[model samples]
Every structure is written in C-alpha cells, then in structure tokens.
Target: MRIAVFTTCLADALYPAVARATVTLLERLGHQAVVPADQTCCGQMHLNTGYWARGLPVVRHHVETFEAALDSCDAVVAPSGSCVGSVRHQHAMVAARYDDDALAERATAVAGRTYELSELLVDVLGVTDVGAWFGHPVTYYPTCHSLRMLRVGDKPVRLLRAVQDIDLIELPGADSCCGFGGTFALKNEATSSAMLTDKVAAVTSTGAQVCSAGDSSCLMHIGGGLSRLRTGIGTLHLAQILASTREHPCPVPEPRRPARRRPSLPGAAR
Candidate 1:
C-alpha cells in the first residue's frame, strides 16, 4: 500500500515533525509513504480569509500536484483536517465560483482520494491500533475542521485508545473550539484569547500529561497558552503519538514559546 503525503501549510512550515511522523507511522505499518515534493497549501487560508479568486490558482496547483501523485499511489493522506477539509470540500467550490468547470471537475476528482491521517488508518486501512506505544496520560482534542467539516468523529480517539500503555483521559469540553481559526485568532484577538483561556483551563482540568490533536495549528495555539502560563502539559500531534514505539519513542514536546517561523507557503509546486 503506497500512500502519498500532502503536508499542509502549518505542518510544512511550523511543524515539519508532525508530517515526518505521519510518514513514520505509515512506513511502520509496512506501507510505503511518498511525499509529492511539489504539493503545497491547498489555498485554504486564502479562501477562509475572503480571497476566493486569488485562491483559485492555489487550488488548481493542489489539484494538479495530487492528481499526478494519485496515478501510482494507493491514496493521498495528510495529518491536517483543515487542509484536507479544504481539499475535499472547498477546492471544487473555488473552481466553480469562477466558472472554471474543467478545473472544478479536476479538483473534485483529486479531493475524492485525499484523507486525513486517522481516517486513512481507520477507514481506508481498517486498522485502529497501528502497533504504537505512548505510555503517557494524554487527552485528545478534536479540531473544528476535523470535527464539523470532515466529520472524522472518534476515529482519532479510537486510534489513541489502542496505544500500548497509554492512559487516555477525557478532555473537558472536548468538542468546543480551541479558538484557533487561522486568522480568527489575529482579527479578533480578545475573543480568541478569551476562547483560548477557556480551552486552556479545560485542557488543564483533565490532569493529562499532554494535549493531543490531529491539527498542528490548534496544538500550537493551545501550546502557547500552556507555555505562557508555565503549565507542564505538552502538545503532540496524533501521528507522533501513533508513531511512538518502544524502540524509538517520541519525546514529549516542550510547550513552544510564541517565537516561531512566519508561515510562507510557496507553490511547494505555486
């Protein structure tokens, strides 16, 4: 089972480790993972921020990159629900919005084959426990795009539950948004901060050693708050958690300071 990885914007720039862990999990399962070196942002941020027309080129580039990869790969997978949600649900809409029916059809075809990491493991591969070991008290947060947009309900939890020696705790208000809606955090700083405060409290109340989510963007947001408050709880992506094994365990990531790289998404093919 050869799979292609579509490493999204945040993961590519800010959290390459998460993308690498996705490949590690796939290879550990005896499936070959190939990264289509040309893939980049699926124009999700452009569309989300009201640059629908400008996003069409990004959308078209995404469709072209993966459409080529799908020629030989069994499936396309990413660790991000937000980017996958855009590919699956928004790519075609961006095309059709400008009367590009040919591009729209191509985007739809590409969208059909893309999957988030957990969905690929659970639904496509029919394996919940991918022979992983974590051995830590962890709580899982389902990001908004994966929860509402992708409807990947409980698939991540199912994967986490199967880890060896892992003590999974229930997150308080698990379904509530972490308030990291990309630019929403920037545009409405006070509201976003307030939401983040609530989310941090909920995460702390769980008494888990780490907070886990499928999206790196959300983890970064939650992690920054945890760092500022000097909470010992760390953040780990689901792929990293699943990629953890006794032979080569994933070290608990320290809460990152707000100082990080500015995301510059090139045509990773634009």
Candidate 2:
C-alpha cells in the first residue's frame, strides 16, 4: 500500500528520529511511504488557541498539500493523535467559517483518509510487531487526545507487547493527560505544570527506563519535568519504539538542559 507520513511539527523539530523510525517501520512492512517535504503543521495550535482567523490559511495549506497525496495514497498516516484529530475534527470548522464549502468538502475527504500511527498499524496494516527488538523495558503513556478523543487504546500496547526483549510495564494511570495541551501549558501555566508533575511521578514510579507515547508534545512536557528533577527517566515516542530492531537500535535522546527546578506536586512549582 502507498502511504504519506505527516511528521507533526514537534516531531520534526524535537524528535526527527521518530519520523525516521516511522519511515523505517512502514518500509519494513513492504509498503511505500512518502515523506512530503511540503507538509507543515496541521494548524492545530492556532485553532485550539482560538486564533481562528490566523489558522485559516494554515488549514487551507494543509488541506491542499495533503489533498494531492491523498488522491493516490492508501492513507495519510501521522505519529500524532492530536494532529489527526485536528484534521478530522477542526478543519471543517475553519473552512465553514469562511464559507469555503469546496475546501470544507476537501478537508473532510482528506480527514477521512488520515490515520494515527497506531490506527494504521492495527486497523489498516493489520500487524503488531514489524519484527522490532528493544532490550530495555518501556512504559507507555497514552496521550490524552489518542486515548480520549481519538479512542486509540491498546493498539500501542499491543504492538509493544509483541516486541522482542521489550519488558513493557503498565504505567500507573496510563490514560491520564500529560498536561501538554498545546497553548494550555502556557495559558494555565500553573495547572499545566501541576498535571505534568503527576505524570512524571507516575512514569518514575514505574521504574521503567523509558516513557513513550504517541504525542511528542506531551512527551516534551513530561520529559521536561523528569529532566528537571534529574529523575533519570527517559522519554520516547511510540514510533521510535516500534521502529527499533536489533540492527537499528533507537537511542535515548541526550537531554538538552537540566530541568530548571523540581516539581513539588501536580501543578506546583518547587
């Protein structure tokens, strides 16, 4: 099958290896995966922040960019549930506001074709393992959108269970939010930090070497807290784990900076 990979903005800038792993997994399955360089942010941040007017053109650009590829590809797959949710749920609202019926229709059509990574792997591709092998134990955090909004449950866990030498641990409160709701982190700074504190605690409590999820944004928030505390808990995306094999091991990223300070509690700064 032919597929187009939409590496979300955070994945592109902060977790490029996640994108590389996505491509690796797709090719390992013997499918054609194209990385469209013209692909940009899905305008989710602007739309979610209520900057509707600013998000219009960005939405249009995405619809146009993916429309061409969707016409010929089997599916448009992304590593982010939030981005997939934006394309599925928000694009039409932006189009309808401007009375761009054609664009709205196009947006809907493309949204229907878009799939989150887990969705594509389990539902469309119909395989769990892709023959990956990771020696370390991994604990997965189901990002809020993928777990609640997208309802992508267990697909990731199922894949993880199938990997060789991957001691998968059930994260305590694995379904809880990681507190990185785009602008929510900035707008309600206190609340966001509070939620991240709990998330990091849960991840550390697992004693798992790595904490992974479908969304890079949430991982960044969770990872930032873990790093600040010098907790030694590493963060990775789901794609990176699925892309790992004995020959091609996924390395834990080097921390960019020490956490500014320790988190005292959920939403509390120490």
Q: Please write out the lDDT profile of model 1 over residues 82-149, one tens digit for every residue.
A: 98999989999889989999999999888888899999999999999899999999999999999999
TM-score of each: 0.94, 0.92
Off by over 4 Å in 1: 256-270
Candidate lDDT values, in order: 0.92, 0.89
By lDDT, who's the top model here? 1
> CA shift at 6, candidate 1, in angstroms?
0.4
Give the worst 10-residue stretch by lDDT in candidate 1. Answer: 253-262
